[model samples]
Target: MQRALLIAAVCVAAVALWLWGFGGAEHVTVWAAEGQRAAQNAMARGLRSLRAGDPGALTALLGLCFAYGVSHAAGPGHGKILIGGYGLAARVPLTRLCTLAVASSLAQAASAVALVYTGVLLLNWSRSYMQSLADSLMAPLSYGAIGLIGVWLVLRGLRKLAARNGDDGHGHDHNCNHAHGPTAQQAGAVRSLRDAFVLVGAVALRPCTGALFLLIITWRMGLAWQGIAGAVAMGLGTASVTLVVAAASVTLREGTLARIAAGPATTRALGLVEALAGATIAALALQLLLRAL
Candidate 1:
């Protein structure tokens, strides 16, 4: 009964979060209602010009969306959404979770750029066949990336679950637990580099629908290049905010005492946190991919 209640709670929380953060994506009217008047006016102007085949109008819209998309997607709030599970882990410092958030946000921005640029290139290469090709290429790439990342998250969750089984059940292993930041020299080493690379890669493995949406809208508007430009801008904006939050979280985690608490009870608590966070992340990742496809 407890397990069932927990599952239900998690599901409820997930749904609420998704709706609060991402509901605009599903309901076009929501965007129309929330967009700044200035932005809406600008978009209206740009659309008119584009419809009339004005090159300048096309250029402006492309630039606007790309910038907006990148900034919005990489923003710190979005990072919170992506790594909230990690932050909830008992054994993990909120700061460490924040770093993961920052890493993921950056990865997401980079991936958005890649996706946008690919769309631009395909449109240019295909000329008259731009629309069909863009949908075909972009959808599969985005959904496939999401699925692959979902699988990885599930595997990671399983590993965490297995590790928990090996614990001595004494609570937090206080004697062995030390939350020391690596020395600068140690951070410069090859192992550190590998870890950094893995973090960045793992964070970016999931595809963002925001980038895909921009690409599609831009293509349909007949502003392929401008669409890509908008994507890049959006990515940068998003990354800036998320990275800062992550960095702040890291700084706090490095100094926190709550991370070092001991006993089997503590250990079990931490293990449960890890398991729940991992499972939540894995489930959401899969759901995103499935919905996208």
Candidate 2:
């Protein structure tokens, strides 16, 4: 039954990949772009209604903000890349990964709020200046941080491979009983928490442009609370999409692991998969960083 389940999961994953590879991605991109344009227009209309003191205008505006976020997240973005890559490379629990995805989205929204408020109220910076800072400075910083994460993953994989090799060279029997020391376990836990922080921080360093625009406009219109609420709504909407990605990545990874024979071979395969995913992430992040610069 377990084998059957694994096979089913693998088959489903394969079909999804096939569809995504054969123009589905492009179609999704076009649809997302259209959704974004429509949402933006609706938001503008909603804002005008709010200015006119129309009933339910605030609700409409918040709904539009959420829709805008979903549409924006559906497009190609580095956040997805980072989340998906980390999910594929790490042996984390699905719930934990999904939680991280949501946290990162919320953190991103918070970053946007912090930046806009700090710039407008404290620094007395213009919208153009804030936008330029995000684009020119924050973007490259985020990409560079993501690149470092990829490198860390690669190193982790290498260490696993080296440990496996060492075991083999020492003629260690797989069936031999051994236990990890408390120090080692504690270190592993600490590393896991650190990795989670880094992943969220890297994504949060560059706030969503749409959120920034909304915050600034709302602030100017004296709807500061509304803007902050809408930004949180948008974050939840974005989390909806990232959660799906997290699920898919976990399912695919688990399915692959289930198919592999347990033992040294499985360990080796996992290491290789992690290393390859990390390498791809690093290469893409490097390219993006260069483009941002």
- Which number leads on TM-score? 2
Q: Across residues 1-293, which tens digit of lDDT does each residue of candidate 2 receive?
A: 55764875687577567646677768778898999889878887888899899999999998898898898888877787788888878767778889899999999999999999999999999999999999999999999999988998898777777777666676556466673222222322323577789899999999988899889999999989988998998888888888888877767777777777666766766677688778868988998899999
How accurate locally, in lDDT, is each candidate?
0.49, 0.83
| Per-residue C-alpha lDDT of model 1 across residues 1-293, encoded as one tens digit per residue | 44543554455456546755877335533442344334445655776677788868766875655445444443222244344444443234444545555566556656755655565565443332443443455434444543444445446545544554555444775477653232223322332344345545655644344555555566767766665565555555555555554443333322231343444334444445545555655566566445545
Q: Model 1 compared with the native: what TM-score?
A: 0.50
lDDT for predicted candidate 1 compared with the true structure: 0.49
Off by over 4 Å in 2: 1-23, 172-176, 179-191
- What is every candidate's alpha-carbon RMSD to the true fold? 9.0, 3.0
Residue 83 lDDT in candidate 1: 47
Backbone clashes, each candidate: 27, 0
Clashing pairs in 2: none
